[model samples]
Target: MKEQYMITHEPPNPVDYNNLRLEGGMSGKSREASEEGLKNSLFVVCVYDEETFIGMGRVIGDGGTFFQVVDIVVKPGYQGQGLGKLIMEHIMNFLEKHTYPDSYVSLIADGSADKLYKQFGFSYTYPKSRGMYRKY
Candidate 1:
């Protein structure tokens, strides 16, 4: 049977965000941090199976000259069903409509996930510039 899912331009609640991140093998952020991050998102897309949150993705930054794709995750059981692509499609749509030509958009792909981002025009930033981050 084909499962039905709902996609919305709404941010998931903190609990759902943390749960999905952990379930997807990403680090879980504190509830307060998750709340604050979602509150500051430039755009968010969430995928749900009925009332259950299954996947989500968000874009955050100044919304003008800089943007970063963050927290792209899908629940373990739902990982290979094209939900990730659906989420990225929405993220790209949002970027296309909201960003200017000079805007800089970026994402730090983990493991094999780089291939997914590549499908949406995200390229490696190695030789010219490297991706750097500081963890406290």
Candidate 2:
């Protein structure tokens, strides 16, 4: 199989978002939720295998000052293929192109994925502050 894939920073399709998040064990997000969230997203990217979406990522927030990288996911079978890196590259590119000087870009790194995010200039906020979250 070929090892190359295309990256598109357009908004992801609702079905694609469902499949992408489902593969990451976050299937609880309904189509309604996906529709709403995607409508407000600042950026989204996906790595497709022909017609199938194998990976995806998104950024959510206001346009100029605040941005958060969210939902970076690759299918289990597609893991370890640098699809994560590809996704991050697209996300970083979007941030670079859209952000103004001194703008803040943030993401909550899950598991050991901090290493990947770090490659794109994301660092731990320890000593300054720690990331916090609430489960619904």
Which candidate ranks first by TM-score, i.e. highest? 1
RMSD of 2: 1.8
TM-score for candidate 1, residues paired by index = 0.96
Candidate 1 structure quality by residue, lDDT tens digits, 1-136? 1357888887888988899999899998999999999999999999888998989999999989999999999988888888889999999999999999999999999989999999999999899998887987
RMSD to native for every prediction?
1.3, 1.8
Please, what are the lDDT tens digits per residue for candidate 2 over residues 53-77? 7888899988988999999999889
- After superposing candidate 2 on the true structure, give the runs of residues whose Cα lies further than 4 Å from its correct spot: 1-4
Candidate 1: which stretches are off by over 4 Å?
1-3
TM-score of every model versus the real structure: 0.96, 0.89
Question: Lowest-scoring 10 consecutive residues by lDDT in candidate 2?
Answer: 1-10
Best by lDDT: 1
